[model samples]
Target: MKNQEGHDNSMNTLNRTTVSLLTCVVLFASFAYAQGEYGANDFRIKVDARGQVASFHDAVHRRERLVPTQPAPLVAVKKGDKTEEPSRAEFEKEPPLIRLHYEDCGVSLDIAVQETESHVSFEIIRAEPSDKVDAVIWGTVSCDHQQDGG
Candidate 1:
C-alpha cells in the first residue's frame, strides 16, 4: 500500500510539471505570433499582444519615437489590488483595425487599434464586466535639450 501511495504522489507531481511546461510553451507561442506592425504612409507602429505599442517610427520625420517606460499597461483591480499584467498576449487579428487581448480578473481586455491615412485610434473593450477594472495610458513626456553656451 505504501509503495502504491508513493507511486500515486510521483504521478501527480509529474502531471503538474508537464502541465506547467506546456502552459509556458503555449504562452510563448501565442505572444510570438501575436505581435504585428502597420504603416499608413509615413506613420507606422508596432504592437504586441500584451496591448502595448512596442515601438513607433515616423519615417518621414527621420527619427524614432516613444520608449516603453512601463513593462505593461498600468492597471488596478478589486480593492485596488493590482493584477499582474501579462507581458505577452494572444493576437486577435492583423493590421488596420487590429485587436489584441489581455487576460485579467477572469476577463479579457479587447484592445482595438484603428488607423487611417493620417489618424490613429485606440479603445479597450471588456469581455466580461467586473468592478475590478482600471487601465491607464502610459503617456509621453517632452523635454527641451540645451547645451552650455560657447
Candidate 2:
C-alpha cells in the first residue's frame, strides 16, 4: 500500500510538470507570432511583430492582397546603398498608425493611415534622423493569384 501511494505521488508530480511545460509553450508561441489588426472603413490590415503586413483585406472587393509568408518584408529604410528593415514594430490603435523601427540604422518611420468611404491612404508622417534616411521603401506585396483569377 505504501508503494502504491508513492507511485501515485510521482505520477502527480510528473503530470504537473508536463502541464507547466505546456503552458509555457503556449505563452511563448503567442508572443513569438504576436500581431495586431487595424481597420477603418472597408480596409483591414494585419501587421506582425517583425513589421510585416501579414494580411491586407479589402472588404468591399472581398479580397486579400498580401501574401504573409513571402520573402519580402514591409517598411524598410534605405541608408545610402544599404537598406535596413524594421527589427520591430509598434502600433497605435487610436488613429491607426504603425511605427517601424530600424534599429540597425537608428531610424524610425511613422506611417499614418486614413480611410474614407471609398479609399484608404497611407502617408509617412515622420522619419527620425531624416538625414540618415535616403528613402523609405514599402515592401513588395504579392497578389493572391486566386483572388486575381489567375
Candidate No. with top lDDT:
2
Over 34-129, each residue of candidate 2 has an lDDT whose tens digit, in order, gives: 666767677787778778878889776878867756845567888889988788877665567777888889988888877676666678999998
Q: All candidates' TM-scores?
A: 0.51, 0.65
lDDT per residue (tens digit) for residues 1-150 in model 1: 226556667677789999999999976654456666766777776766665667677666645665546443422223255654444445534433433333445544455667678866666555345454554333332222233253
User: Listing every candidate in turn, what is its Cα RMSD in Å to the true structure after a full C-alpha superposition?
Assistant: 9.6, 8.8
Which regions in candidate 1 have their CA more than 4 angstroms from the true location? 1-32, 68-84, 94-104, 134-150
Angstrom error of the Cα, residue 139, model 2: value is: 2.0
Top candidate, metric TM-score:
2
**Full-model lDDT, candidate 2:** 0.76
